[model samples]
Target: MLINLSGVDKDNYTLSILKSLEKHNSGSLKITVVMGKTAPHINSIRQFAKTAPFECQVLVNANNMAELMAQSDWAIGAAGSTSWERCCLGLPTLLLVIANNQRTIAEQLQQVGAAISLHVQEIDTPKFTECVAFFRQPENLAQMSEKVVRLCDALGAKRVAQHIEDLTKNEDFANIRRATLDDCRQVFEWRNHADIRQFMFNTDELIWENHAAWFAKQLGNPDFIMLIYQVNGVAQGYVSFTRQSENIWEWGFYLAPTCSRGQGSRMGRLALAWAFAELGAAKIIGQVLPHNIASLKLHEKLGFFRLPEKNDVAQFELSLDKCYIKKQFHSRFKIE
Candidate 1:
C-alpha cells in the first residue's frame, strides 16, 4: 500500500496510520510513504520505517509519485488536487480531509464510490482499521478502482484542448436510439450481470427464454419505449420508459457493465432530455431500491424530488419544466 503525505503537514496523522498498519502488518505487507522535502518530522518517520515489522520505505519529495501510485493496490492520502491525479490512475484511495475546502470533495468522491473519505480525527478509530481491511479485499479494490477511473481517465487536459478546437463545430457526443432485435442478446447479458441485477427489483438470474419473450413483448408494446444510449456509435447504456398516463412515464436505466465511469450521468442527461422533447413526457417517475444509493443520488442530482416511500421502495419524480431549467443552467455540456 502507498501513503502519500507530501505537501501536507500531517506527520502525526501519518504516524497514526503507521501505528494501525503495524498492528495489522504481516510479513507480506509492504508500505511506501512519500513526504515533502521540508517535512518537519522526516527523521522520526525514517526511524520508524527502519524498525517497522513489515517492509516500509520513507522517501522525501519522491520524483516517482505517479509510478509509485500506479504500482500500488490502494492508497491513503489527503483530499486535494492530487485526488484527481489518483483518480486518473485508477487508484482506490482512503481520503483524509485535512482542510475545510477538501471536505466537500472528499464526501462527493465517497458518495460516488470513487474513494473512501474520513475526517482526520477518525484516523485513530476502528473505522480507519476497517478501511484498511476493506482495501485488502481484491473485489472491493477492483470496484473502487473502476469507479475512480471513470471520474478521470488522465485525459482531462486533452479533452479540454479538443473541446476548444471544436467549439465552432457542431458535434454530438451522445445520442439515444430505439432498441431493436439486434440488441436482444447484449441486453440480456447486461441485465443478468451480477452488478446490474443486484439493484434490480428482480435479482434472480434470468433465463434466456424468459428474457427473449419479455424483450419481444416489450418491443411490440406501443406504451413501452426502450432506448439505447450510444456514444460515437457504440451502445453504452439502456433506458426504458413505461407510459403510466398522459405525459407521465415510469423509467428505468442502467449502463453497460463495461461502460466507463461518468457515462451514467451523461446517459441520464441524454435520456431525460429525449423523454421530455421527443416522447412529450411532462413528468418522469423512477423507483429505486433503498440500497441503491448511487441511483438515489443520481436522481437527486438530476433534480428529481422524492415522493413518499412505498413498501420499502423509494420513488422520485422530475417534471419537464424543472429539467428544462436545470439544463439551461448547466449548459456547459450540450445534450444534443
Candidate 2:
C-alpha cells in the first residue's frame, strides 16, 4: 500500500498526488492516505481521505510513523522526515513536496531513481491515470522495486547523513577541486538566480541552497557533471554535462549575469573542445529551446548538426571525428 497525506486539501499540488493514488486499482495494490505532521489543514485532509475510495490511514503520532511504513513495500510521503525514513529503509517511495525545503531532496532522489517527483502544475488527469495504470501492473512494480534497491546502493543514506553532519559542523570550503562540493554551491546559486532559474529544466522556483544540495548529490555520479570556467580569477560561466551513455554526453552551458558585458561564445567553444579532446568523448549533444535563436546559432558555429525533434525540443549533435573537424585540426596540428 502506498499513501501520502501531505497534499490532502490545503495544497492543490499535494491534492494531485492523492488524486493520482486514488485512481489506482486497489485490488493489487492497497492505496491509502496518511497526512504529514506539517499539514496545516489536517482536518480537511482527513475528511477528504475518509471519502477516498480506499482505506485512508491517519498518523496520530508522527514518532511511530517509521514503524508503520516498515510493514509496507512502498510508502508515499512528503519529501521530509517520512521520505528520509523511507530512504533509510530502502522503501520504494514517491514524493509530493509541500514545502520549499523538500525540493532539493526530492530532485536528488528522483535523479538517482529512488522516487518519482512530479510537479503539481504539470499533473494532468490523463497522465496521472496513465501512471496509475502503469504502476498497477505486476511487472512494472517489480522493476521499480529493483530500481529502488539499486538507487539505495548508488546513493547510500549514510553519505547524505554524513554531509548533513559536516555541514552542521561548519565544514571548510577549501579542498574542493574540480567539480567539488564548492562547485555545487556555485552551480546551484546560478540556477536559482532570477535570470537563469527561469531557463532551467527544473523551473521549480527553488532557493539557492536547494540547488546547491541537488548539485552536491550529482558531483560523484558519472551520469551528471558540472564544469566552471574561470578567467583572470573571476568565475565567468559554467558548462554542464548529463551522460546519455558511455559514448555520448549531453551538454548545456550558460553565462553568469546574462546582463554582463560581452558574449561568452568563445568560452563555450573552449569548454566544448576540452570536453571532446580531454574527456575522449565520441559525441556531444545540445538542446535549444525553440525561441532561443542565439543559442541555436552558437551551436551551429561549433559544427553541431540537427537531430530528430523529441518533445518539440531542438536537438543538435557534434561528432568528434567529422570531416570538417579533421580539416581544422590538420590545419592547426600540421608539422612545420
Candidate 3:
C-alpha cells in the first residue's frame, strides 16, 4: 500500500498504516508514504516509521504520483485530485476526507465502490487492520481495482484516431438499451441467421411463433436482462444476462453480420460494465461451443477464465473480485 496525505496535516493516517503493517504478517505487506514538502510533523512521522517492525518508508515527496502509484496495488491518502490518479492507474484506495472540500468526491467514490472512505476521527489501528485483511485476497482486490478503473474510464471519447485530422469524427456510443416486444422479430431474424444458428447448442432452426412467446416471457422476467445496442440509431447487436444465484450472472452476445468489425468486443464491454456496476454481480459465467475459437479468445481477453467442459461446451467464468480483463478499453483487431 502507498500512503500520501497530499499536504494535509493527517499524520494519523500514516500511523494507521504503520500499525496495520505490524499487525499483519511480516514480509507480506509493505507501505511507502510520500510526505508533504513542508508539513510540520514530517520529522516525527519519519522517526516513527524508522522503528516500525515491518518495512515502511516516509518520503518528503515523489518524482511522480502516477509513476510510483502504478507500482502498487492499493493507495491510502487524502481524497482529492490524487484520487483521480489512483483511479486512472487502476489502483484502489482507502480515502480519508481531511478537509471539508474533499468530502463530496470521497462520498461519490465510496458509493460507486471505487474507494472506501473513513472519517478523520476513525483513523486508527483496527480500521486499518480490517482494510488490510479484506484487500489481501486476490479476488477482492481485483474487483475493487476494476470498479475504480471502470468508473474512471467512463469518459465517452473513443481513442480511434490515427491522425490529428481524424479528431472531428463523431463518437457514437453503442448505446445499450432494454429490448421490448417490438424488437422480437428483429432479434428473431438475427438469432436464426445462418452464422448464429450453426453454433447454437440446439442447431435446429428457431421458428418465429415459438421465439415470440419466449421473447415475451423474457421481457417480463426480472431475473433476465436483454439489451439491444444501437450505433447511430441502427440496431447492430444484442447481449443478455440471466441471474443464476444472488450474485452470479451468465451472459451471451452476438452481432449482426452487417455490423462493422470489432463491434462485438465494444458491445461486450458496455454490457459487462453494467453487469458489474449496476447489477452488482460478483461473478459472470458463460459457455461457448467447442468450435467457437473466436468467442473463446474474446472472452479470455475480457478477463474470463476457462472452466472444465460441460457436455462438450466450454464453460468460462469471471469473478468481479478476480477480474482479469486487460486494461485495453477497445479492441485493436478488425474482425473480418
Candidate 4:
C-alpha cells in the first residue's frame, strides 16, 4: 500500500493512519510513505518506522510518485491533484478530504465508485482496516480499477498542448518517419521490456544477436516497413507493417517504456493514417493476445473490427473506409 500525506497537517493525519496500520498484521504488506520536502513530522514517522510491524520506506519529496503508485495495489492519500494521477493509472484509493476545498473531489469520486472518501476526522483503525480488507479481494479491486481509469486518461496536458500548437503554429505537432539503423538498439530495448513482452504472442526473452540480425533484415526489405513516431524530434514509439498482399498489411506497434499511458492512442491514430493514406493499404490487420486488454481497447477505439479468433489469438482488421471515418472525427490533428 502507498500513503501520501503531502498537503494536509501531517501531525494530525499521519499518526491517525499509522495507528490504524499498526493494528493490521504486516504479513506481505509493505508501507510506502511520501511527504513533501519541508513537511513536518519527518522525525515522528522515522521514529515509528524503527518499530513498525510492516516493512516501511519513507521518501521526502520523491520525484517518482507516479512510478511508486503504479507499483502499488491501493493508496491512501489526500484528495488533491494526485487523485487524478492515481485514477489515470487505475490505482484504487481511499481519499481523505483534508480541507474544505477537497470535499467535493472526494465525494464525487466515491459516488462514481472510483474511490472511498472520508474526512480526516473519520480516520480510525476499524475504518482503515475495513477498506483494506475490501480492496484485498481481486474482483473488488478490478471493478474499482475499471471505474477509476474512466475518470481520467492522463492526457489532459498533452491534449491542451496539441490544441495550442494547432492555433499558433498551424503545423503538425507529431510526425512519423521511416526507421533507421540508429534506432535499432532503442527499439530492441523497448520490445524486450517486461511490460511489452508480457502481451506478445511469443513471450520468450530475445537474445541481442538474434534481434540484431532480424532488425537488419527488416531494414533492408522493401515489403517490411518500420516507422518511428516522433514528437518535436523525439522518438516516442514505433510501428511496423509487413505487406501480406498488394493492398493488405499486417502491423504491430509498441511505445517507449517511459512514454505516458495515452501516447499509444496518438501513435495508433498516426499509424493508421499512414498505412491507409501513404502506403495505400486497403486493409490493415493486427493480432492481440486475449489478455492484452489495453491493446484490445486501443484497436477498437481506432476503428478496428474484430474478426474470428484463430489459434486462440484475437484478430482485428481496419479498412480504408473505416480509417477515413476515424480521421474525420479527429481532423484537428494532422495525420501525416
Say which prediction, candidate 2 or candidate 3, comes out ahead on TM-score: 3
lDDT of each: 0.87, 0.64, 0.79, 0.84
Q: Which ten residues in a row have the lowest lDDT in candidate 1?
A: 325-334
TM-score of 4: 0.48
lDDT of 2 by residue, 1-336 (tens): 656544343554545665665565543445545655566766665676677776665553355555666676666566875565576656776566667888898898888777777554545456555655655566765666666665444356689899878875672211101456766656666766777655666667667666666777777787777776665445667787788888789998777774254445555565666666556678999988876667878888778898987888889998887725434432332111
lDDT of 1 by residue, 1-336 (tens): 898854646446788788777876545778898888877877888899999898999888888889999999999999998999999999999999888989988999999999999998888788988998898999999999999999986878999999887894675467778899889998999999999999999999999999899999899897999999897788888999999998999999999999987787778887888788778889999999999998999999888999999999999999987667345523544444
How does candidate 1 fare on TM-score? 0.48
- Backbone atom clashes (below 3 Å) for every candidate: 0, 1, 1, 0
Return the candidate ranking by lDDT, descending: 1, 4, 3, 2
Query: What residue runs in model 2 are displaced by over 4 Å at the alpha carbon?
Result: 1-177, 258-262, 323-336
Which of the numbered candidates is closest to the native, going by highest lDDT? 1
Tens-place lDDT per residue, model 4, 214-331, is: 9888999979999998977889899999999999999999988898668888888888777777788899999999899999999998889999999999999999865574455246
Model 3, 1-336: lDDT tens per residue? 788887746455666556656666746667788877877778777887788776777777567777778888788888988798789888988887888999998999999998888876666657866776776777887999989988666242344344433753566545677888988999999988989887778878788899999999999998998988788778898889999999999998888878888877777776777677668888999999989887988898787889999899999999877762322332321111
TM-score to native of every candidate shown: 0.48, 0.42, 0.50, 0.48
Displacement of the residue 16 alpha carbon in candidate 1, Å: 85
Best by TM-score: 3
